[model samples]
Target: MKRRAHLAGLLALPMFWLIGIYIFSLVMLLVTAFWTTDPFTSKVKPGFTLRNFEQLVANPAYLSTAVRTLVIALAVTVLCMLISVPLGIFMAKIAKPWLRALLAVAITLPLWAGYLVKILAMRVTFTDAGFFNWALAPFGITGPSFSITTVVLTLTYLWLPYMAVPVYTAIRQLPANLFDASADLGAGAWRTIRTIVLPLIKPAIIAGSIFTFSLSLGDYIAAKFVGGSTQMIGSIIASNINLNPPIAAAFAVVPIAFVVIYLLSVQRTGALERM
Candidate 1:
């Protein structure tokens, strides 16, 4: 009884915050999404309506922005996985202790920098008169201007550490004998990884992707800094939040629904449980 009481006590605060704050906020957002905006006064009108959602679906611009946001989010996730796996294996399986520490530090160092600063730095690098263009000038290669590609690259740089660190940690926690056993069985490096290492690290990869995908989905600042005129779902929400809050709320539901569906789908794979 005492142990149960203590456990309940420990959980009470978090449970309150989750239910009272987070869930309540979501409820409010849902209610707000059904509201209507008065065009004459440009004020939010309290009511239930499907016009906001109908408009959201009917607007080509909004649809394009949603698709673009999803594409960028997916691109960032894939790019991070591509970069993390080989680097994580090297750090966990091969690098010396000091070298591993150095690599870990290198991977995490960018995270300490301000997010705005990083976006601005990318903006500078991708600009025509900036470092990237200057370096490529001798090779007669032009630098990429602010565009969807720039947005993806900047976001990938920002979120790579989130994916890499978890993947590296997962690899480190793996039993060393697994690799040795695979080697004894005549399994090559790639084959061992495909059969054993990859399977074990799948949970960690999913965990990292949750961070990258959700962050990229909601990112407006990076798009603002380096996306030129390209707008994302986040930017659309930002634009409408004050003048037409109902529409913003309606659009906000898109990413929220995407993330919830994604989580539910991956949960079936046992990724969330492992995390």
Candidate 2:
């Protein structure tokens, strides 16, 4: 009884905050999604209606923006996976102890810097006379103008550490003897990675992907800075929030639904258990 009481005491404050504040806000937002706002008065009038959702479904621009955001999110995840896997392997399996430590620091350094600063830096880099174009001039390759390609590249840059760190940790946790055993059986390095390492690291990759996908899905600031006129679901929500909150709420639910569905899919793959 005493131990149970103590445990409950420890959980009391956080539970109150989560349930009372966080969950309560989410409930309010979802409830508001079914509500209507008065156009003449510009005020939220609470009543049940599915019209907001219908509008979301019917709007061609909204549909395109949602599709565009989804594509960007998937691209970010794929790009992160491609970059992180081999880099993770090198950091975990090949680097000397000092080199590993240095690499870890290098990987984590960007996260310590402000996100806005990094985005701004990328903005400068992609400009016509910026370092990217200047460096590529000799190769006759033009820098990507402010476009979807730039958005993908910037997002991938921002989220790479999130994927790489977790993957590196997973690879490092793997037993060294597994590699030795695979090699003893005459499996080459590529074969061992495909048959052995890939299976074991699948969970960690999925874990990292959760962060990359969800963040990319909701990002508005990066898109605004580098996307030119391109708009994401978040940008649309921000635009409509004060004027038509119900519509914003309705749109807000899309990414949440996408994330929930994604998590469910990943759950079925059993990758979450590894995390």
Candidate 3:
């Protein structure tokens, strides 16, 4: 009883924050989605209506934007996975101790900077007169310069740490004997990674993917600075937030739904439990 009481006390603050702030905001967003806006005044009113959701499907631009956002999110996740796996393996198994520590710091360095600062850095890097274009000018090549590709690159840069850290940690936790045994069994590096390392680190990969996907899905800032003419789901939500809040709320639910579906899909693999 005493231990249970202590545990409850320890959980009290976080539980309250979860229920009171996070859940409460989500509930409010759902409720707001069903509300209506006055056409003339452009003010939100408490009422139930499906018009907001209808607008989502009825408008082709919104549909395209949602699809584009999904693609970007998926691209970022895949890029992070591809980069993190090799990096994690090297850092955990191959790199010397000092080099490993330096690599770890490099992986997490971006996270230490402010979000907007990093986005601006990418903005500067890809701009016409920025480092990217200037460096490639001698070869008569050009940078992508404020496009969907830049958005994906920026997002991958922003979220790579989330994916890399966990993957590296998981790989580090793996037993060294597994690699030795795989080698003894005539497994090459690629075969050993495909058959052994990947399966064992599946949970960490899924966990990292969740962060990269969800963050990229809901992000408009990166798209704003580096995407030029690209419009994402979050862009629509931000635009309508003041003039037609119900629409914004409804659009906000799109990313939430995608994330929930993703979680459900991954849950079957027991990844969520491992996380």
Candidate 4:
């Protein structure tokens, strides 16, 4: 009882800080999404109003930007899963400790570098003299530059580790008996992956996909330097921040609301899984 009381006291301030800082800020945002701002007075009205939200819903530009973001986010999610699943399963299957460690470093080295620098490196490396165009010459797949492909590839590289690490963790956690059981049941390597491996990592895939998708969706610098005039939601929101703070707030609220609902669905699915 005494130790319990001591731990409770230790946790009290952290809990308070989490609520006051993060939760309260989210609540304030939800409030501000409705709180009207007067252009002349520069004062935000306290009462609820949907003018900001309606403006976002009515405008095709904002709607298109959001749709584009979702499309890009989903593409990134698929690519991350495609890469991470095999990489993670391979890491988990590797028996030697030093070899696994080397593989892990190779996987995460890209993430260790700064995001801006990574994108810039990609940008410079994609020019006519850059590796991308040079490598593509034989294939005849040439383009001006910074196409949707560039944005997708840049975002994918940026968030690759985020997906990889989680998936590796999840795969490593799987029981060894599951694989042995599958083999004993006459399942081939492909069948084992299709049935046993993929199902086991569904939670990790979903979690990592969400994280990577959110990161790509919210990335501004990559979209700016490499994806110029692509008009991603991140750039749009950044543009609106100073000029239309409330509208920006509204834009912020939508993604927040989306993630909250998504997280809730994940939680519910997890609970069902537990049951």
My TM-score estimates for the predictions, one after another, are 0.95, 0.97, 0.96, 0.87
Which stretches of candidate 2 lie above 4 Å from their native place?
none
TM-score for model 2?
A: 0.97
What RMSD value applies to candidate 1?
Answer: 1.5
Clashing pairs in 2: none
Instruction: Give lDDT for model 3.
Output: 0.96
| Runs off by more than 4 Å, candidate 1 | 1-8
Tell me how far candidate 4 lies from the true structure as C-alpha RMSD in angstroms: 2.8
Clashing pairs in 1: none
Candidate 2 lDDT over residue span 1-275, tens digit each = 99999999999999999999999999999999999999977699999999999999899988899999999999999999999999999999999999999999999999999999999999999988999999999999998889899999999999999999989999998899999999999999999989998899999899899999999999998899999888999999999999999999999999998999999999998888768
Candidate 2 weakest ten by summed lDDT:
266-275
If both were scored by lDDT, which would come out higher, candidate 1 or candidate 4? 1
- RMSD to the true structure for each prediction, in A, is 1.5, 1.1, 1.4, 2.8
Clashes of each: 0, 0, 0, 0
Q: Whose TM-score is higher: candidate 2's or candidate 4's?
A: 2
- Residue-level lDDT tens digits of model 1 in 170-224: 9999999999999999999999999999999999999999999999999999999
Residue 109 of model 1 has an lDDT of 99
Global lDDT of each candidate: 0.94, 0.94, 0.96, 0.82
Q: What lDDT does candidate 3 reach at residue 8?
A: 100
Candidate 3 lDDT, 121-197, residue by residue in tens: 99999988999999999999999999999999999999999999999999999999999999999999999999999
